[model samples]
Target chain A: MSDFLMFSLVPMTVAIVICMSCALLGNFLVLRRQSLIGDAISHVALPGIVASFLLTGTLASSAMMLGAGVSALFTVAMIELIRRLGRVENSAAMGVVFTSLFALGVLMLEWNEVGTVHLDVEHALYGNLESLIWFEGTSLAALVDPRALSDLPPQLARVAWMGALVVAFVVAFRRSLVLASFDADFAASVGARPTLVGLLLVVMVAVAAIAAFEAVGAIIVIAMFICPAAAARLMTDRLASQVALSQLIAVASAVLGYVLAGYGPGWMGLGVSLSAAGMIATLSGGFLLLACLFGPHRHRREALST
Target chain B: MEAWWRALIFDAGYNTSLVTLGAMLLGGGAGMIGSFVLLRKRSLVSDAISHATLPGLALAFILMALVFGDGRWMPGLLVGAGLSAAVGLWAVQAISHRTRLGEDAAIGAVLSTFFGLGVVLLTVIQSMAVSGQAGLTGYLVGSTAGMLAAEAQLIALCSLLLAAGIFVMRRDFLMVCFDPVFASTNGVRVQRVDMLLMLLLLAVVVIGLRITGLILIVALTIIPPVTGRFWTDRPLRVVALAALLGALAGYLGVTLSSVREGLPTGPLVVLACFVLFLVSFLLSPRRGILATLMAHQRFKRRVHLRQGLLAMARDEAIFDDLTMRVLRRQGFIRRDGVATPSGWAAARDAEHEERLWALYRQYYPEESAQLDHRGLLPIERVLSPDTIMVLENRLMMGRGAHP
Candidate 1:
């Protein structure tokens, strides 16, 4: 029973932590009307991973992160350039740049099969939770650190390091991030550097993406980033309440999804990860629908205020 | 270079490239219709349809597999894509009319949920691995290299039909796009026209899925129209230019990929379209940045020349000497320091000649015998004393009456 608790409950707890952090960070993105940027960055991270592999010949977390961050920044820059040039709409530019980069990454992977790049593709697209289970010894160490301090397993140590980094960053920069997100122009007028705030957000997203890639994969990371925030948006108009609700949604979805996946089938069957991601998306969508139906008419408020 | 050309022209693999081209042409024509979809801001509907079609595809595959014990991928894909498009449009309309959700929000809800359902269905289907399921993943990811001659031919036929439909209803479609209210008031069946346009959009998206895939299909539909906008203002011209641009991008993307082993043609094609848009935005003659800047410069020069002439005219003592030099330089002024006949005539033309006559008519509709004798009075004392005073002050100050 304890083993089951450790296998299921512990993982669920970890997933909630990761997913809630993603949703919390994603709030600013959604509020800023840049919800699709998460999707773009997620796709753009492909070339970064591939380039890192080519340069280092191993998927070291740091190298991959650096590559992803740079690529994501590039994608942002391309979108800005497109807008400044006034040649195409912002969304179209995003589609073009991210898709092209992703295609390039696919081509590169095809050209060179250093080792299991195809499997990495699948992992990047859908995530490999089994691999995360094996490689997440670092998280376990952190969980047990208060009770017992021993030489921790390497994988668990890494997970713990990443988790702590994420938490610390969010807590440290919450106010400024929220301010910049709500009205970037206003933030700039009031002596906040919108660019700096934007960079911090992008870095945060990239870090979360890398961390989640270990568990859920890259393609569905978008679901984690977007779904909870979208759901929260429906439930609350206040930023604080939205953030809190999003985290709640994320954590709940993670726990429920983990349980279903664990008990449903062993192997060669529909697993919990994809189902969980899909469920979260569906549920969040449902919440938004309900909000649209029953929530106070925010559009009326907007019209009156304007 | 010669050997490379030969290899490209003669290789068996080249057949695949040709088939892909054929599919793209068909797809591009469909995309031409789909551009109207994007312009209508119903872009996300295409996405909803793509997602909604998944169940149909799965059902078709399952039915075929159970009955014939064979998986026929193309037939299944077609049936699935067509059904989903129809259902998606219906659902969009139903939600909007029956519910209070705005169009964008409704679209967002339907697209995400349907796509999620498709993902769920796809995961289940993958586990089964029926014989026909081998290349099913490729359908989502898309692989132009696998296209066959028959598929190409079918796509071409669809493209021709779409083109014909568009041609037949060009005027109605244009009216609808510009102002649906006006079209409806004028006795056009706006609803039927809109549905037909959407059907064309659906057909294009589904057929293009063979090359561009579902996720990036919107890009193909949108990019061409946006690029074409930079090149023309007329609707017919815009449509033709967009189609040509799309075709060119398709050809270039495929050709570039053939030169290299690793390039994915879909994104390359999109990138090419983006480049064309950028170039047109910067350099096209009528609406491009360069043209606007040039016009601004020219306007500034004209204003400066007019101001310089006015400044010289205000200073009568220095005017005569500077007038000849300035006039020679400007070409509009004359060699004489005093206002030459041509210079005076040009100045009068530039001033409010129409307003001066209107003022004259207001005060003196018929002959004014007293004012007709010009030399009998001082130039300032001509007609109504107030009007003459105002005109004399403006002429002496060298300020144009209109400005």
Candidate 2:
């Protein structure tokens, strides 16, 4: 029972935290038509994580966070530069820059005498969420004991901070973010610097992405950044309700995905635990599909209303 | 240099050469089909479709294992990829056409969701204890180093079919791209033409998926045509140039990967295409960055010179010395800084343009403020239909102050 709680319950909490944080910020990304930046940033963050390992010789959180921050800023600047200089479309520029960065990360990992270390491209692509166990004080009794709170895994703590940072950022800049997302010129006229607000939002996204990278992997990070928010958007028209709906969906996906990933294989006679990150992403996709077909604002109804 | 030449020609191993040839063919076919896709403004739609193939591929693998007692055939996998990609494209079209979500949102939704589903399937496949299951990861990040000659031959055959199909239907494709409403009115099957192009896109994507991987395969289709666009405007020339660029990227990317020890082949090819794109963006004679900058500078210089001439013609005290020299050199002014006859005529034209600009500023404060004084003069060469109509009405009213 302790093993079950340690393995299943703790990871589910971590997944929920990661999902809610990503989905909250994603609501604005979808509103601003910059949903793909999530995809671009997560892919580009691979080299950041790898570089952090090479520099520190350990997978330290602060170093990796700093690396991810630098890499995200660099990716944004490069995408803008490519778009301006090459006159390429925004999506094409994103595709080119992020893929090159990811390839560079792969090459670096290969050059660094790969298999001796814990990091690998495969791991980065699909994370090892199952390894995030409560090893410090593994007991169901730890849950009720206030002293045992400190025994929480470091990754869980990091995600908790990430969640706090996301909430703080949204609260601090909610008005500016909303105005900038809807009308930049109006935002500017109203003393809300859209560019600064955008930068702050991107910083939060980078933090969230890097924090979740070890727990959820790059693909799930991208999927959470888009699918939950998009599904919520289809369900509502107001931004506030949309954000609420997105968080609800995200938490539900995390819980459902974690349970299914743990138990679904056993039921099917495979006798193997699958990847929680992949299952969460898949479940989020399922939610998006359902929302598209049967949500309050179905496509045809949206069209007619508009 | 000699070694480089040898490798470039025929000295690379048979597998290397075969892979390179296959890449080149795939690139050419994607380039041609991508032209239509780009024209349709569905560049990102192709990305969503490629990602959507993952679920289909996994599904095919499982079904083959369960039903047919075999799961690793190349054709079966590709068939699954193609079917799923078609569904993805159809979803994109349906959502964008039917909903207020717009194309970008629809694309993001479909891309992430389909890929997420695929990732889930992959996890399931990994736990099934199937032998050779690890190879499925190759589709995510392609491994061209281990491409077999038989697979290369298949790529070549499919590429050839794609090329022939596009070649025969070139006219119809062009017509549809240029104006679908007109084509439909002319009794051309526009939808059929569109479906044909989508079919070709699926073919190219499935083959290129092996060579470039799913993550970067869209680049093979998108980058080449955008590069071609910088150098030409003619439809045939754009297609030809795109095909050439794609072939070059394939050849160079493959060679680079072969020479380097651990470099990924797909991204290397994509980088090669990007390098070419950057070159064309900066150096193309007509639409290049350098050309645009030069044109802007030349326009600025002309504006300064004309402003000087106008000042001299008006006898304004703010006239500069360089303006006087340029006006004198052009015989627009005498040595005494007096306007000559030809100078007066030119100055009148310049003054008229200024008046037009002044008039333009009243109506569009922001737009006219952004323009230089001479910006409106170019419009005199080919008057806008609205402007022409306005001028005719003014003339009828006997207000003879022509701009």
TM-score of chain B of each: 0.71, 0.80
Candidate 1 pairs with clashing backbones: A127-A216, A127-A217, A137-A156, A138-A155, A138-A156, A138-A157, A139-A156
Q: What is the TM-score of each candidate against the true structure?
A: 0.73, 0.84
Tens-place lDDT digits, model 1, residues B1-403: 4433543453536555564455457545744675576456565566566655655666666667777777565856687767865776676666555443344434444555555555555555665546867556545545565566677576666666766777677788778888999999999999999888888777777776666556556666766776777777787777777777777766655555555543445655666666776688789887677887898776655554444444444533343444455555666555444565665555544344333433455556664443453222223344567776564465545546445
lDDT of 1 at B199: 81
lDDT by residue for model 2 (A196-238), tens: 9998888888888888987778877888888888889889888
Give the clashing residue pairs of candidate 2, or none. none
Stretches of candidate 1 above 4 Å error? A1-14, A113-115, A118-121, A135-203, A210-215, A265-302, B1-18, B42-63, B82-116, B189-192, B255-265, B271-403
On residues B179-206, what C-alpha lDDT tens digit does candidate 2 reach at each position? 9999999988999999888878878898
* CA lDDT, every model vs. true structure: 0.62, 0.79
